[model samples]
Target: MTLDPQTLLAILAMAVATAATRIGGLVLFGFLTLDRRQKRAMEAIPPAVLMAVVAPTALATGPAETIAAAITALAALRLPLLAATALGVAAVAALRAMGL
Candidate 1:
């Protein structure tokens, strides 16, 4: 499939925007010093963000997704975030394949 000039430009713009945001965040954070409370808050941010993004879909979707999310949460307790996410995805795929 061929991308038109406008589509190419839009893709480039998005790439630039994404890179700028990442670099901007790094630069902004590099100069800041975090205390104990701030560090704790930062530590909490990842799970909170994950929940914010996942909760609605998990709640609204079918049992497969919900069960997958539960497994992900349990795995999160013992595994790294990426591994837990992978587990959730795998669970959902397996459940769906079984016609759940």
Candidate 2:
């Protein structure tokens, strides 16, 4: 029911700092060229970050989710992103439906 001025100011400052750093990275990348390995590493970043964020929660939930996450990871090795994601979703749904 109340908003604190100091907390709001801190939040605004953090937002500005985050925006500045993101824009700065874009500007810096614009002036730089990455070689083959660097390019590949950069391209893999999004998925790596995604897994890092999701792995803990997925594994911690229960056996059903852990199995599905493993299935998804293995599927990702050979299948396209969309297909792998769909398979993972289906696996979890089926497992949960069976009272996992």
Candidate 3:
């Protein structure tokens, strides 16, 4: 199937907008200075963003996902973020396999 000119242009515009947003964040952060409070807040952003993206679907889906999310959140307190996230995924898979 072929995209019409307007559709193609819209897609291109969206791509550019996404790129600009990401690049602009990097560029802005590069020259910015942060005090302790600001730095702490900045450090919190990743997990918050991750939860924002993950929570709705995780909670909305089933008990397995909800339990997995909770396990992951607790793990995050002691484990690295990546490890915690992986644990969450594994937990969900295991729970599903066990027919939870």
Ten contiguous residues with the weakest lDDT in model 3: 42-51
Best of the two (1, 2) by lDDT: 1
TM-score of model 3 (CA atoms): 0.81
lDDT of 2 at 36: 100
- Model 2, span 1-100: residue lDDT tens: 8999999999999999999999999999999989999997786665566567779999999988988888888887677667878998999999999988
The predicted structure with the larger TM-score, 1 or 2, is 1
Q: By summed lDDT, which 10 consecutive residues of candidate 2 come out lowest?
A: 43-52
Q: Write the per-residue lDDT of candidate 3 for residues 1-100, one digit (tens) a residue.
A: 8779999999999999999999999999999999999997887777777888899999999999999988988887777789989999999999999998
Query: Quick one: how many clashes does candidate 2 have?
Result: 0
Candidate with more favorable, higher lDDT: 1 or 3: 3
lDDT of 3 at 5: 100
- The residue-level lDDT of candidate 2 at 21 comes to 100
